[model samples]
Target: MKLLVVLVSFLAACKAQNPEPCTSPALLSGQLTLATQNEQLWAFARYLYDALGQRIRLQEMGFYQNKSFTYDALLLYREGVMYEINNQESTCKKRALRADFHPMAVPRNASLMGQAVLGSSSGPGQGVLVNTWTGHLPDNARYLVTVTEFGCIPISTSYRTQPFGWMVTSFFNNVIGISDPNQLNPPGFCQDALHEEPIDFFSLFHMMK
Candidate 1:
C-alpha cells in the first residue's frame, strides 16, 4: 500500500504533458570533437564538469541543485566504459525525463566530447536543444563527469530520446534505493560518495591530484 501510495502521489503531483503535433524529427547529428569551440556548449561543459573538477565515485548517488530543484544522478563505470543515469528520481520529477538518454560510453582515459542537435518532431526544422559536451578524464579517473540536472539547459521537449522540458519544470529529491540491475555494481563502490556531501567538481578534481 505504501508503494501504491507513492506511485499514486507521484502520478498526481507530477504534471504530465499533452504534446502538440511534432512537426519534425528530433535529429541530432555531429562528429565527436574534443576541442571544438562552440561557446554555448563550452559554457554548459564548464558548468557540467565543474570546470573539470568535480569528483564522483562509482555507485555513488550525487545531487546537483539548479533552479531550486535537485537532480539525482549516478556516475559509475566498469572495465573501460563509463555509465551514467542522469535523472533517477521517484515520487518527484518522475515525469521520466532523461538527459544523456544514451548512457555516455566514455572509455577510460578518453574523452566523450561531441556536438549534437536535439530536435522537436512537433517543431519542424527547429532544434529543441543545441549544444556540445566536451569532457576529459584523468588517466586514473573513476567517474565520468557531473551535471546540474538541467545544468546544460537545452531547448527541450516533454518526450524525446532523452526526456525533459515543458513538463512541470520538475523537481526531484530522492536520490537513492531505486531499482537498477547495474546500481552500485562495478569496479568500485560508492560508500565514499554516500558518506561525504557532494563537493564541487573543482574539489573533486583536486582529490584526483
Candidate 2:
C-alpha cells in the first residue's frame, strides 16, 4: 500500500512539472517593442489583437537609418488584406496578405525549455510563473518565446529569419480586452489606397529600412 501511494505522488509531481499547453485570450491590447540585431531598425507600437476576428492593428513608430517615421497598419487576415497608412505622408497602401492568423499559443511541436518565477516566490502576489518554449515556423524561421504560465500572456519572443537575421519583440502593458473596438478599423484615408501586389509581411521590415 505504501509503494502505491508513493507511485501516485511521483506521477502527480511529474504532471505539475510538465503542464499542458495553454492558449492566450482572443482579444488583447498591449505595447510592443521590436529590434533587429543585424539591422539598424527599432520599432515601438501600440497594438490591438483580435484573434477571433482574425485582425490586428498596430500604430507604430519606427527608426531606421537615423530616420524616424510613424505608420498604422491594419491586417485583416480573414480577408487576406493589409493596409499600411503612413501618418507622416498622409498616404495609404493596400496589399494582399496571404498569411493566416496565428494565435498566440504554444505550437504542438514546441519543446519546453523550462519554467521560472520572475519574482520572489515566497512573496505574496509578487512572483509570476513563466514558461519558455522553442519552435520553428513553417517558413524555416526559428523562434523562442516566453509566456506567463497562468494566462499564456506573451512576454517576449526572439525569432531568426533568413533575410533579416535575428529580431526580438517584447510585449508589455497588456490587458485582456481591446480598449476600443473601432481601433481595428482602417483610417478613412485608406479607403482610396490602391491595392498593390501581394508580398510577404516580413518584407515590410525591409521597406522600412
Candidate 3:
C-alpha cells in the first residue's frame, strides 16, 4: 500500500510540474487556423496580418513621433499592396487591401499582437487597433494591449507537406481603446518585451478582432 501511494504521488507531482499548454497571450502570436465555417474570423486574421506587414515601417515612425512615418491615408482593404509595393502614387493617409481569404498555412516562429482588433463590418472602417510596441514601438511608452481567453494546440495528425506545430488562437480586441500607458499602473508579462529596444519589427504582426 505504501509503494502504491508513493507511485501515485510521483505521478501527480510530474503532472503538476508539466502544466497544460498556454491558453491566453501565448496563443496570440504564431501560426493560426480556423474552420471554413469560421470565415469571418479567417478574413479578419488575414487582413490584420497584411496590414501589419504593409504598415510596419509607418508604425516605427510613430515611435519617434514621426508622422511622416505615417504612410498615406490609403485604406487597407483595397489598395494597400499596390501602395506598399510601389510608393509613388499613394495619396491618402491610410491604405486598405483585400484580406487573404484562402486556407493559410503559416510556419513556426510567427505570432500576432494581442491588442490588434477587427473593426465592425457594419460600421465604417474606424477603430482597428495595432500594437506597434511588440517589436517596433517602444518600452518607456505604455503601448501594450490585452488579449483574453487565447489558446493553442498542436495537431497530432495532418497530411500537409510543410512542417507545422501549434495552432494558437486568442480573443483580442483593438488596442485603440485601451487606457494610456500612464494609466495601466503596473506593467504585465506582455509589457516586459516593451523596454527591450532595438527590436526586430519584422517578427511582429497584427491579430484579427
Candidate 4:
C-alpha cells in the first residue's frame, strides 16, 4: 500500500509538470511590433482580433527606406477578402486574402522547448509563467513561439524562412476582449475600393515603400 501511494503521487507530479495545450481568448486587442531583416521594415500596429467572428483590424505605422507610412487593414477570413485603406491618401484597395483565421494557440504538432518564469518565481504574483514551442512550417520555414502559460497569450513569435531572412513579431499590451465591436468594420471609403488581384498581405508594406 505504501509503494502504491508513492507511485500515484509521482505520476501526479509528472502530470502537473506537463500542461495540456491552451487556446487564447476568442476576442482580444493588443499592440504588436514586427521586424523583418530581408524587408528592412519595422512596424508597429494596434490590432483588434476576433477569432470567433473570423476577422481582424490593424492600424499600422511603419518605416521603410527612410520613409514613414500608415495604413489600416481589415481582414475578413470568412469573406476571403482584405481591405487596405490608405489613410493619408484616402484611397482603399480590396483584394483576395486566401488565408484562414489562425487562433493564437500552440499547434498540436509543436514540440515543447521548455518553460520558465519571466521574473521572480520565489513569490506568487511576482512573475509570469511562459512556455516555448517550436515547429516547422510550409516552404521550409521554421518558427519559435512563446506564450503565457495561463491564458496562452502570445508573447513573441520568430519565423526563419528563405528569401525573407528572419521575421519577428512581439505582442504586448493585450486585453482579453474587444472594447468596440464596430472597429471590425471596414472604413466607408473601402466600399467602392478597386478590386485588385490577390497579394500577400506582408507585401503590401513593401509596396508602400
Pairs clashing within candidate 4? none
Error of 4 at 17 (Å): 3.0
Report the lDDT tens digits of candidate 4 across residue range 1-209: 99999999999999997955678899999999988877677889999989998999989889876788776888998898898877678788899987767887878888899998988899999999999998887665789999998889989999984545788999999999998998798777788988899966556666655
Model 2 steric clash pairs: none
RMSD to truth, every model: 20.1, 2.2, 19.8, 2.0
lDDT order of candidates, top first = 2, 4, 3, 1
* Structural similarity to truth (TM-score) of each candidate: 0.17, 0.89, 0.23, 0.90
Q: Report the C-alpha lDDT of model 2 over 85-146, residue by residue, as the tens digit.
A: 77667788999997778988888788889999988799889999999999888888889989
User: lDDT per residue, candidate 1, 45-144, as tens digits?
Assistant: 1111111112222222122222122223333212222323333322211111122222222223333333344455466666433322233333332222
Best of the two (2, 3) by TM-score: 2
For TM-score, the strongest prediction is 4
Best by lDDT: 2
Q: What is candidate 3's lDDT per residue for 5-34, written digit by digit as tens?
A: 999999999877532223221111222232
- Model 2's alpha-carbon lDDT is 0.86
Separate clash counts for every candidate: 8, 0, 24, 0
Candidate 1 vs candidate 3: the TM-score winner is 3
Provide the lowest-lDDT 10-residue window in model 3. 57-66
